[model samples]
Target: MAQLLACFRRRGGATASAPDEAAEDQQQAAPGPVLVELFSSQGCATSPEADAVAARLAQDSTGEGAVVVLGFHVDYWDYRGWKDPFASSAWTVRQKAYVEALRLDTLFTPQVVVQGRAHCVGTEQDALAQAVRDAPRYPAPAMKVTFQRPNPTTLQASFTGSLRSRVEGPGGASVLVALYENGLVTDCGRGENKGKSLLNDHVVRRLEKVAAVREGASARKTVSGTVQFPLWDGFRATRCGLALFVQNAALQVLGVQHFDLPDNV
Candidate 1:
């Protein structure tokens, strides 16, 4: 099995998009879909626009190159009066980790991290798109995922993925997966966004680091992990799905992808 996985990883291919303003920044063809992380807050007045940018990218076609966008609502702004129910301390920790890994002085909302390589103010629409275009492409990992409802209040899913060589490096790797919901709206009671009903997309609900890739493992490392959604009953949103990110030892990311659940199964 290990030898077979290694052979498959070595056979992975790279693809180049047509050179244009959008594709100029990339060094080579991406191996998989680009992952975009939006660290935002409902308390932020400018978060709406940046949130929309994520929506646009999520609908894009991958035949060109797939893109996965996740909105991580941070908790610091909760004290502002209008607590973003979607906000999580975990998300804040994730952002802070990036600040130190990227050597930034501090953390801020409305920030977008692309492929964990490049980041910019989330509201910078043009730069966000450029960053995605400029990101080093990795192949969309070969993913297999399925969901089941064993009993009420319990949602379970099992997912597996095989990483590609373009996204791997000397440093080892880690796989992080998240559960997100779409078409969510928040009616702010107090704060800068008070009196407004805000819409958000791909709002992450749960995230977990499931596995670690060894330093000398198969370039096409394969990992299988399970994700549980405990508060599943409370969320009433369209297009609930799962997303995965594979990062290297330095916390730099290789790439990411998303898997959506069907209405019936």
Candidate 2:
């Protein structure tokens, strides 16, 4: 069995380094799907135009290829007239790190990080389109995840996989398990979504760390947890994915996955 697993891993082109390095290299090697990270705030009045542009780009079609867009609600604008409910201090710090890494003095409301290397104003239509068109592709991770639901309201998922690493580094990597609930409606009386009943897909409500993958080694960790939703909303959990990426000392996402989550759960 072990021998078969090893063969399978090799056949699938598994890597030994952190997934981020592998992914970065893969993107450089081939034209893969572009992952667009939009940094915006609900409190910023200038963000809506950028948000609209992002939404449109997400819906565009480039053959069978598609662009992945992630909306990171920044909290820096909370001190204004409204406090964004989706804002997080971690996100604010993350943006600042990007600024420092890129050597910039100020951060804006609609900043977009493209492919971990390029940054552009989110509302710039020409720049956004060009970035998407010329975006480099990365290699997809060989991590296979299985989610087991013992009941209607609970799920148990176990992940076992290896990411291609660039070097033989020490310390196991960190497994970040993020759970996003789709079809969320918020009546925002204050923030950016204010006065608008926004229907958001892939809305991340819970982000949890299930385990710590050891360094210089591949991991096969299993985490069991339950998410109970009341019978009133009849809302079901739609998508769940595990992003196995390598982070620098600054905790920036060197590489990431916008993987598809199981819909039945």
Candidate 3:
């Protein structure tokens, strides 16, 4: 994991020659959505506020770039008193990856990672807004995704797209697809948030790496793959959505697109 985090540094350097104006213009014209990941927990007393903040950000679409918000419930605080039903150890590992990549001293709840480039206290709306505003934007991936319910317990997704970024370094780039649900209400019966009713939006239920963009990949690389997800008990296509993002070796997001699962599928 340390080795993986080592590859996650900011991507920048001087070019050998002048930049191409046309390419720059195209990039600006199709700036990608900003991914705002909130590492929170129902076991934490302060996380509810951050969760609310994330919900607000998810609804905001009037800006220059779209904001994609995801709520990751970490399980580290589950032992305090009441166990958070939404908490998962996998989510904790994800947050730790960011901690190592960002060189942070320790982990804490109500944390926000913006575009995998900036981190701030999740409760700090001003800081989160500033980070979003300051983060660099890339063009959205031109991908078409389709879904199918292979069985009552599974969902199959297939995607194809031309990735525009150059994938370099040992870690390469990954095509990650996240399955998320909205309009969740959890009643915390124990733990730090005991007796409080918690509302969560964009909660990531499952995250999978569908494919990898190899090192030194070309701009017109043709990539396609099918991934299967074991659906949760109360899964409803109408209440769920899929978010696909291409992340480079440095763990920086290059491009992202969201799809609303068809009700019939």
Candidate 4:
């Protein structure tokens, strides 16, 4: 029987580190799907344009290199007359981690982080495109994921495989999984976006660290976990998808894989 590695929950306060360029260059040379993360808030007037850009990127599939888009709604703008229903403080912390890793000054709306390597204004299509184009490529994590619905409002996922990239030094690597929704429409009644109809896709609803690869850990291991969803937030298998990525201690994304929720889940 294969040994199931113990997985731990993610904790706050870990200092973020910059990417290691030398180690990154030694990974697989093949180009893999690019991860484009958009940080925006519905309460911000400028977010709609960035959301539209993300939607366009999500629909683009003609290019040889694939792109994976995830929209993270931050809660900082909630105080501006109207609270964004999709916003979460966790996403804000995640963005701040990137800010610290990239040595940025502060947070801003409609920001895009590409492959966890670079950031730019999300609404600036040219800059976003350039960042994606310049981002380093790596082979996909050789893993297989299976989903199970142990109960309504809860999702159980089991993953097994080897992380194709190498991990050296103190903090090891992290296996992060995110649940995102598509085709969402919101009507803003107040705030800067008052009376505007906002369309958002690839909105990240839940994020979890299912497994951790400690320093000197084996290359291949099995891990699983359950993600609980709020009853108020509807879960439609057809409208939701999952994205998993292997990120090293320096905050560089080593590999990525995406999966659509099975209709029956």
Candidate 1 stretches greater than 4 Å from native: 1-30, 166-171, 236-238
**Candidates in descending TM-score order:** 3, 4, 1, 2
After the best TM-score superposition of candidate 1, give how far the Cα of residue 197 lies from its true spot, in angstroms: 0.9
lDDT string for model 4 (148-195, tens) is 667776777777656655654479888888888988999999999999
Model 1 lDDT tens row, 20-134 = 3354235233466677899999999888889987777666534444677788999998888888988989899999989988889998989999888889999887898888788
Every model's TM-score: 0.82, 0.65, 0.87, 0.83
Instruction: Show model 2 residue runs off by greater than 4 Å.
Output: 1-31, 61-65, 148-156, 164-177, 191-194, 207-235, 239-256
- The root-mean-square deviation over C-alpha atoms between each candidate and the true structure, in angstroms, is 8.8, 8.7, 9.4, 9.5
| lDDT string, candidate 3, 1-265, tens digits | 0111111111222101112445644553456678889999888999999998877766664345467778899999988987887788999999999998888999999999998888999999889888988987765565666667778899988887666555645677998989999889988898888888898888999999878888778655768778999898888877777777888777788766667676676
Q: Candidate 2 lDDT, tens digit per residue, 90-177?
A: 7777678888877788988889877555789988978987876666543333455555666665555555544333212354444454
What's model 3's lDDT at 46?
A: 92
Higher-scoring candidate on TM-score, 1 or 4: 4
By TM-score, is 3 or 4 better?
3
Single out the weakest 10-residue window by summed lDDT for candidate 1.
1-10
Q: Which has the better lDDT: candidate 2, or candidate 4?
A: 4
Query: Which should have the higher lDDT, number 1 or number 4?
Result: 4
Model 4 TM-score, 2 decimals: 0.83
In lDDT terms, how accurate is model 4?
0.74
